[model samples]
Target: MEMNELKAITEGLLFASGDEGITVKQLARVLDVQGHTVEHLLEELKYDYDNTGRGMLLMQSHEVFHLTTKPEHSPYLKKLLETPQSTKMSQAALETLAIIAYQQPITRTEIEDIRGVKSDRPVQTLIARSLIEEVGRKEGAGRPILFATTKDFLTYFGLTSLEELPPLPDDINTDDLEEEADLFFDTFSEQIDQSNHR
Candidate 1:
């Protein structure tokens, strides 16, 4: 097929994938082309979109490609994307989400340990919203639920995967023995404040 035709097909596939971009390997398999060819096509497509005056453009973040309308177009887009009918999560839910995001595959007991308070309501709310999920059962007696972020969580946060999470500051040493006590209080204090506000 012509490069132009392949580019068109690739663009459509990327659009259909939404926040998940097709890897060059995946695109090559589908297009019956070399991976390098797909990469070149993607670069060309990105250049075309960038150079054009289109209100929407193709962008790749965390190896995922998507067409995002410019932020300047928010006013026009909001009418269709939002209705005053959306359900906003409570502050408690946001805190719970942050904890789960940083320490996933953790059990409720672990979350409580980190938060120094009960997380039942926030955990339930996150699960109901399809953000966090029971990824597995712990090996211990009674097998407590082990929670983890779901694909919906990644999409909602505009991340391709957990690996795309931003780098943490090197100064914040998570393993420092001296800072352990302070870290616990800091994490739990935020949780308490969120709970009280909710």
Candidate 2:
């Protein structure tokens, strides 16, 4: 395929990969080209994005490439996020989010065990919002899928990292878990509101 065609295909793959991004090796394998060739194409693409006055940028992190909006466009992105339609989160979803945040890499069964109710819908909602994702699978009989918070979650909460999360109270009673979830949601929402105003 032509270089231009390969570049276009690489762009699509990068967009589809989301936060996971794509490695040069992965791109080369998919495009049936040498690794160095893929690296050259990526450099060309990155240069084009930098010079074209495009709203988006091609970013490299940990040798993985992904498409993301330029930092200068953050104010507009914040505006979009502040819209009521986009900010809404149901109570069930909030509860699930709190549970996932506190006990990430947790399985659905574990979440249900804590809540004492079915959590399929809430889990789906979190995934749809891009706040949580399938981080891995548990090592057990069924190898149930494990969920974890995403970078989007940190941004939404105005947290720089997971280490910034408030520590959970020790020696807490099991009955207070639901209330704790509510507290977590309130804290996160407060931070998000503060971030939106800035």
Candidate 3:
């Protein structure tokens, strides 16, 4: 096929892959072209998108290629994400998120220890909301999955960085996580509002 047709096909494959994206080797196999040719097409496609001022950009992560909106459009995207209809976090979710936000790369066990309750459901909820993710595993037995906040977490909270989060008390009272969650949520919500307006 022609170069333009192959480039179009490559772009379609990336789109169809969604968040999972496509790998150079995988694209080569599917396109019946060599890996180097796939790489060339990707570079050319990236250049075309950049030079043509397309709303989408090519992002490569760990050999995976994704077609995503340009970063310059984040304000519009954030507006959609912050709509009032968005799901509000439950008390349990808020507590769990607060702990994770402060003590990130923490395990579910550690979160449970602080909250003094099972955190499986809350962790799953955060993962589903794209607020937190399994960054990796711990060092010890069973090697439990370690969770950390995602970029979406920062976006949703209207924070530029984790440092922007309200500071935790010098002595966090783990015994009263319910009250702690309430206090944190109140402060956190205020910060979010402030961030959005700035």
Candidate 4:
């Protein structure tokens, strides 16, 4: 195929891969081209995005290439994400998020055990909002889905990384899981407020 055709195909593949991204080796194999040739094509594609001033850009993290929105568009993105309809996370959802944030990669059964209630609805809500995602599956009888927070979780809470979360109180008892979740949510909200002011 022509270089232009190859570039277009690569762009389509990147878009299809979503945030997971395609690796250089994967692309090379798929395109039946040398690794260096794939690298050249990726560079050319990156140049096109930079030169054209598109809202989307090609990002390569850990050797995986993906298409992502440019940072300059974050304000608009934030607006869309924080609109009235989407901004209202229910108390259950918040509790679920707190558990996922702290106890990942936890399974639904584990969350229910801590909360002392079935968490299917709240889990669904968090998944729908993209706050938490299925990171993997457990190695038990059912191989239950393991849940974890997504990058969007960090962005929503204005956290650069999970390590920035407030340390749990040393005196806090692990038996009071609900209280622990409440404290986590409170701390997360305060951090978000602080970040917004900056």
Best by TM-score: 2
Q: Which lDDT value does model 3 have at 194? A: 60
Model 1 CA deviation exceeding 4 Å by range: 1-86, 173-198
Per-residue alpha-carbon lDDT of model 4 for 1-198, expressed as tens digits? 899999999999898765456888889989999999999999999999999978889997656788988999978977876686865666667777887898899988788777777787788678767889988777855456789999998987768998976677789778887777677667566654564455
Task: Return the TM-score for each candidate structure.
Answer: 0.45, 0.53, 0.49, 0.52
- Let me know the TM-score candidate 2 reaches against the reference structure: 0.53
Model 3 spans with C-alpha error above 4 angstroms: 1-86, 171-186, 189-198
Report the number of clashing residue pairs per model: 0, 0, 0, 0
Residues 31-87 of candidate 2 have per-residue lDDT tens digits of 999999999999999999999898889997656688988999878877875677866
RMSD of 4: 11.0
- List the global CA lDDT of all models: 0.70, 0.79, 0.80, 0.80
Model 1 over residues 1-198: C-alpha lDDT tens digits? 999999999988887654334567678889999989999899988888778877768786545566766888778765643454435666566666766777778887777666666677688668766889888777865356688999998877667988886544557765553353245344545544554455
Deviation (Å) of 163 in candidate 4: 0.4
User: Per-residue lDDT for 15-93 in model 3, tens only?
Assistant: 8765446789889999999999999999999998899989999998666788988989978867765676545666677
Error of 3 at 119 (Å): 1.3
lDDT of 4: 0.80
In candidate 3, list every pair of residues with a backbone clash.
none
Q: Which candidate would rank higher by TM-score, 2 or 3?
A: 2
Select the stronger candidate by TM-score from 1 and 3: 3
Q: For residue 108, what is the lDDT in candidate 2?
A: 80
